[model samples]
Target chain A: MVTEEEIESVSKLVRIKVADHREHIEKVRDMINFFEMLDSAGVEDDELVMDDVPVSRLREDAHESFGGLSGYVREYRDGYVRVPKMD
Target chain B: MNHSSIIRASALEYVRGVTSGEFTAEEFLSETLSRIEEAEARYNAYLHVEDGQKLLARAREIDRGIKSGQKVGLLAGMPVSIKDNICMRGSRTTCGSRMLEGFVAPYDATAVSRLNAEGGIIVAKANMDEFAMGLTTEFSAYGPSRNPWNTGYVPGGSSGGSAVAAAAFECVASLGSDTGGSVRNPASFCSVVGYKPTYGLVSRHGLVSYANSIEQIGPIARTVSDAALVLGVIAGRDEHDDTTADATPATDYLEGIEGGVEGMRVGIVDEMTEGADPEVARAAERAAGNLEAAGASCERVSLDMVGYSVPSYYTITAAEAASNLARYDNLRYGYDLPLDGYEFNSYVAEARGRFGPEVTRRMILGGYVSSAGHAGRYYLKALKVRAKLTREVADAFASSYDILMAPTVPILPFRIGEKTDDPVSLFMVDLNTVTANLTRRPAVSVPYAVSAGGLPIGIQMMADSMQDRTLLRAARALEMRRPPLPEVPD
Candidate 1:
């Protein structure tokens, strides 16, 4: 079972400050729930030979195809793709 | 009016009309801009919408080219919205995260470049879950993208904005990425068609990675034909993306639009149906009956290990995510902390601080799973389980089923904030769709049913790995059987 301290430790290890997740009760509940589900799953390990473990795919080599202004405006602007910055 | 009719009126019909010399490309672009303006206030579907002055200029240019007898691109006049994660050189690809707020891309993703090359107009940037992490657009740093169908509910995400924009006719089609059903879930919830091509079928050169192994750039459209048309513009191999395979040829998916499923074999997954809401199950059954009536053969199939897919996907995705997101640590030009006394700690602290709750939670979980000590027990075991699951699906295909049919989501879209507080419940929402992602297969979510209250549900279609065109063809055929969707209620 996941303990309150264990959840906090894990959360800290991952670098997230769980501001208000003060109660570890639900956290433990989820862990127990997760493992309980897994415990009943009797999975088997088997190997099957399939067509290609790693198959090579051929792609057409083409360049610089722009349909119209709608396409261009949708893609280009700013110094790059615009996204919100974290302050 | 139904979205299909509007599509016919403004997009397809407009194109046909232009061909007949009744109007010009400029006219269609103007109408689309007008529609986007009309719906923008309530839907919150777009992250950014250009004033159309520049787009109109291009439309006029295309119109002049047509009049001058110049050969224009196939989508010469259609306007398309782009999910924010895919880069368009010089535009900010936010990935719906405040961490990268105002982060600009140095270049266009392969798909965006292809769309621009084909003459399709880029209308706007659509909103989504932070880093494409959640099923509901509610996780967006920008705010939740409302369902065009029901503003009270969400447009399924992390491609929620794209789906809503498409469903509400804000754009003819939009580009979205699906890793663990980002595109399909939104499409399902929004009542439109969202298609994820087989893994590696489309180049991922410029898509901001969520889960690199599973993420695929796909299309969201009002109709299957539009989705297929957009896929034609984007699908291919790019040398920059080594994971792209050389196994199959990309076909003109439009050719398969009218090709009825004469003798194709469809597998109805019992696992996908069990525990699904009655409305969702009935929708799948109804679609199956329609296909059978149209000359396709249907059979029930069992995926005994299917239940493990969500957890397995989570395990594997978290591991990969830890590695992929490592770059966001305020370095080399992503969101960076102001370089002060110490760069390293500042960057690390800033990244950890700025990332949303869901993003931070998953990254932490991912790091933990891939940690040296836990690697074997969690990550490695999950990979082994994935291999087994993939093999099982391959065997199922080998047993004669061409595609697996199921409900894209087991339930209708939920109200905003209904389950965001409960991360586990939110994650389980993708249980039915994650299997396709884990197996690296192609799938589509087409609107299947409208509830008594009028919310839209979707039917999912999964094709074997590398059979991207075949899946599109089947979905297009099924699209013909579904009803035209009505306008999303406020």
Candidate 2:
């Protein structure tokens, strides 16, 4: 079972606040226990199949004009997205 | 004309009517809009219906083109609803989350653009589970979409509204995204035809990411041919999505679809049927029997790795989802909380807090599985298991069968809140449908039988990866054999 502290640590790592960490801890524990079923599949010798497209065949990087740039960014000034201060 | 009849017409019928000038596209759009308004109050299928005048204006152009001897595109003003996760330029594409509540998309998803280019009219944005995480529409921030068959029950989700819109005749067809049975589950629950193409067959560009590796935009319609027609339109290589294969586009999915399934080998997945509701299992068996009567050979096929599909599916999806959804950090496109005198982390936390419970749970679990220590033990192991399962399914198809069959869902549609409390129970409902997503194969759900309680049960048919047309042909054969289903009454 996952402890509340572990849930808190995960929440911080994921950058999402858990409203009731205690309630979610038990639910998360139950789900992890369900995931434990994967241990029985015995895949130690299996070779991973890489289905992704090869990088060599990729299209050349080219700029395409999009008219909706203003709609996509929540806050933009002088064609740049504005972000909150970090320090 | 009865507005319901016009809405209930097959997508092909609508296309044919508009292209041949048999009925003005404007008249058809008005009837469809009126039916949507009538059904919206009872079924809650649409999150946002397009303005009737805009849709009618587009339809009027198609009619004028037809009269002017100019060839209109294939779909030619056929009305369709898009699941809200798929971006349509200038429309709010909320994925049923408060995080993107007021966010408007600047560009259309590839499928949306294709549908528009083919003259398919976008009538509404359908509701879904927030971030496509839940099995029932109950997780949607817009509230649950009620099953048209019984307003008290849930329309299965996260494509619940898409299925409901098609089933209730609010649209001639609808588009949905399937990651682990989202399309097929709702299609079964609502008695519509849903098709989940092979993972890369349909481009994923402009779809709000859930699990990048597993999800694909699919089609929902009232009939098998209509689903195939829509699939033909939305599928093929997209320059934007590199994951798409260099395969030939299916230009004639409706052609020769009525050809009977003679000499085709059908496998009834033993593992998928073991613990399914008796009615669901029996319906699958009945479907098999129907296929056999159509001269297809049927047999039991055992896939030992099938049992691991659900766990592997959830693990991979959660990990992918955690990575895919991390971009909604309030800085760019989604709902933002003011950071007045607050730390950057706190602002992000507040913004992400807008996610519903199910999305939060999945995201948290995804983080847990992919974290440093657990990555090797859980995430890596899950990938290995997924690899093994994919190989096993490929081997099964190569040696044993041309197609596999199973119940689309394990049970009938439950009341809205019946399974919401137990998250595992909801995950279990996806047992039969997740394998297709995991294996990256094509699957379609067609309504096979209705329960004594009058709820519809659908049987899922799967074909090897990229064999989507074959699956549709089999579904069409079965659709031809079954008695036509009655329309859900308003």
List, residue by residue over B1-490, the lDDT tens digit for candidate 1. 4222334453455556665677777877787888787788889998888658999999898888778878767677778889998888767777888677666676888988888888888989999998888889888888989987778898899999999998878888999999999999999998888999899889999998879878899999877777888888888878778777666475477775687788999999998899998988898899999889888999999987787777778877877876787667544343445545544544465556667767776776676667776665666666666777798899998888988999999888889899887878777789889988888899999877799888898999999987776787788778877766566663
lDDT of 2 by residue, B1-24 (tens): 246466667988888777776787
Give the clashing pairs for model 2: none
Instruction: Calculate each model's fnat, 2 decimals.
Output: 0.13, 0.62
i-RMS, each model, one decimal: 7.4, 1.8
Q: Model 2 off-target regions past 4 Å?
A: A68-70, A77-80, B333-336
Best by DockQ: 2
Which candidate ranks first by TM-score, i.e. highest?
A: 2
Superposed Cα deviation of residue B91, candidate 1 (Å): 1.1
Alpha-carbon RMSD of each model: 5.6, 1.7
Worst 10 residues of 2 chain A by lDDT: A64-73
